[model samples]
Target chain A: MALDKQFIGREYGPYRYTLGEEKMREFTLAVGGAKPGAGTPGEPPAHVSPLLYDEQAAKAGPHGGLIAFPSFAVVFAIRPFSAAIADPALNINMQMLVHGEQDLEFLDVMRPGDVMTTTGRIADLYERARMGFVIVTSESRNQHGTLVVKGTWSAIIRG
Target chain B: MPRTYQPGDTFTHVRECDRYRPIYYAGASGDYNPIHIDPEAGSAAGLNGNILQGLCTLGWVVEAIAGFVEDPGRVRRVKARFSRPVRPEDTITFQGRVTAVQDGRLTAEVSATNQRGEDVLKGAVVEAFIG
Candidate 1:
């Protein structure tokens, strides 16, 4: 089924998420990266640093909260795609899709305890010669309504 | 405390694009795009070759910073704009510089350049220096 052009510019909900340290560790491990732990005498892990949760160390930054891992925002930004694909109205088969491109802009750093709300919109939808493309843009804001991150995702729907 | 970095402080790491790496990233990221896996599908879509997922390249950048700080937690913020597609067999060199250090925070401009020296990703990363 072809994508409905009218869906373009349509906005989705302001879904909320809470950042957690364990989740970060899980994401890292799932990505084939090492988990943070104390180093041994001769061998140290390639990835994983406890500095993220050290209050004294992170307090050195402009924000006093624990510094988030660089790719932490991916957790929040990816939710909307599943929602869009699951919408019965769209009829998008998840298996027949490919992620074409993605871009993210961090306006500010978010702390571990920060409660963030993300609102997504179908920014663009088009098709070309049996292939379809959908672009979704999601903006995440902290509890104070401060913009934390803006994410753009493009999916290619194969016919 | 204001910290300034000289030109010689820059660091670079080159990575070979392994075909299987994209599948690994796809499983982790939940992005199953055929172009990243199926060569014929990618060619049919007008891609020069089976391209790597954008997040996979971002993951490399994350890996680069993770090596520098020795701890992923020290990174406060990271953002990047994907400018080009990364093809399989292409070697990408991750480059970074300490652009500024203000109020005890370190700001670095980082990028990934292909073997052709074309910029694939460009962005800034902010890290908290415990030292």
Candidate 2:
């Protein structure tokens, strides 16, 4: 089904996501990053340093700040895309989908253990021949509603 | 503790993305999309050739930031948008600047641009510094 341009700018929910350090490490490892000081595929290239642990403590503690993973915002922005694809009127099949493109803007840093709420919207929709493209942009904020990240994702649908 | 930094501080490296370095990212990340590995599939899909996963570029950017801050775990946030595709044999350079330093946090605007000068991904990263 063709995407509706009218949905552009339509906002979705303020979904919440919690940041975790182990998950971030797992994700980095999963993506082939070298571990700190370990010369292995997907591990960080060098030791992360003990100073980071102190910083992490400060950020994760009360009255401290938050530290967010690089691509953590991807989890939040998927909401609007799911809603758009799940719409009965759109009739999109989950199996044939492809992630065409993605864009993210970090306005502020989030610490591990920080509570974040994400609000999303359909930013753009268009079609080329047999393919339809839908773009969803989401903004993530802390509990105080302070903006942390703005993410824009594009999915290409082909029939 | 106080930390000192200069504006022109930069580090650069080049690695070959070849057969041995195979696109192992697909299975590890569940992003087993054909365009990253199957050259024929990529060509059939209208791509100039087999393309590197966008996340790989992100991983490189993360590595650059980790180097700059000297601590991978201190990276609090990374925000980027994929602007173009990085095909096999495409050498990418990650360039960044220390745009801001305030209240012990260093903010840098970084990007991955290809040999063609086209931006493959661009974003800002914020890291907490402990000195």
Candidate 3:
């Protein structure tokens, strides 16, 4: 069965998230290939930037403080897209769903204590080659109302 | 002195999907989908085994550019299509080539390939600010 077109413009979230310095470090290290274990996110890899994990170093660097890894935006920004797929109305089969594509634009650096609020809407729903595609667009703004991130998330439902 | 970058410049990064990486990523990213953490669940989902989160692969793409610009904060954009699943024990190598440098921003086209030589991401592009 095809996805219902009526939910095409369905919207999700003004989800709010507060960036934490340690969480930011953990994410940066994990993606940087740190072997995370009990009580630690693992030692920072050599290639990992201090701006993302070393508070003191970051405070002394150009940004003047710790900054989230660029893609850390996905942590909170994914809320709306996840909600859409799990929406009862969408009736998407969890087993058949797979992330298909992603686009993220960062307009400003995110620092600890920055509050981000994100909102998103289903942008399109269509079937191609017997597969269903769900596209969603999201925008996240900081407490100061600066647009910090914009995302285009896509999911494919195997047919 | 600041570094200079121009079109045709290239850089590479490699990542391995260690057995527990998906679980750790789930803990950090709040994506606890069973298919990513449970081999049985993945098999039931037709994946044969648990797979790494595509977002994590996307993060590697950001790392490639951030390393190129020498700053993570300078990364302005990253986009890609997930062409294949990255399973545990798989090593994906990311190779990026600068395609444009204009108005203080540089764009690079990136490709992510597994050890088997299969492309995991298609149409990958990253942009960063240098000014």
Best by TM-score: 3
Candidate 2 residue-pair clash tally: 20
Worst 10 residues of 3 chain B by lDDT: B24-33
User: What are the runs in model 2 whose C-alpha is more than 4 Å off?
Assistant: A1-3, A11-23, A32-44, A47-68, A75-79, A82-119, A126-133, A140-149, A154-159, B6-8, B13-23, B72-83, B88-90, B99-111, B114-119, B122-131
Question: Can you tell me which runs of candidate 3 are displaced by over 4 Å?
Answer: none
Against the native chain B, what TM-score does each candidate's chain B reach? 0.83, 0.82, 0.98
Runs of candidate 1 with Cα error greater than 4 angstroms are: A28-32, A35-50, A53-56, A59-65, B5-11, B14-53, B62-92, B96-131
Ranking by TM-score: 3, 1, 2
Q: Tell me how far candidate 3 lies from the true structure as C-alpha RMSD in angstroms.
A: 0.8
The digit string of per-residue lDDT tens for model 3 on A1-159 reads 498889999999999999998899899988898998889999988999998998789999989989999999999999999999999999999888999999999999999999999999999998999999999999999999999999999999997
Q: What DockQ does each listed candidate score?
A: 0.26, 0.26, 0.91
lDDT (0 to 1) per candidate: 0.67, 0.61, 0.95
Clashes of 3: 0
Candidate 3 local distance difference test against the native: 0.95
State which candidate has the highest DockQ.
3
- Number of the candidate with higher DockQ, 1 or 3: 3
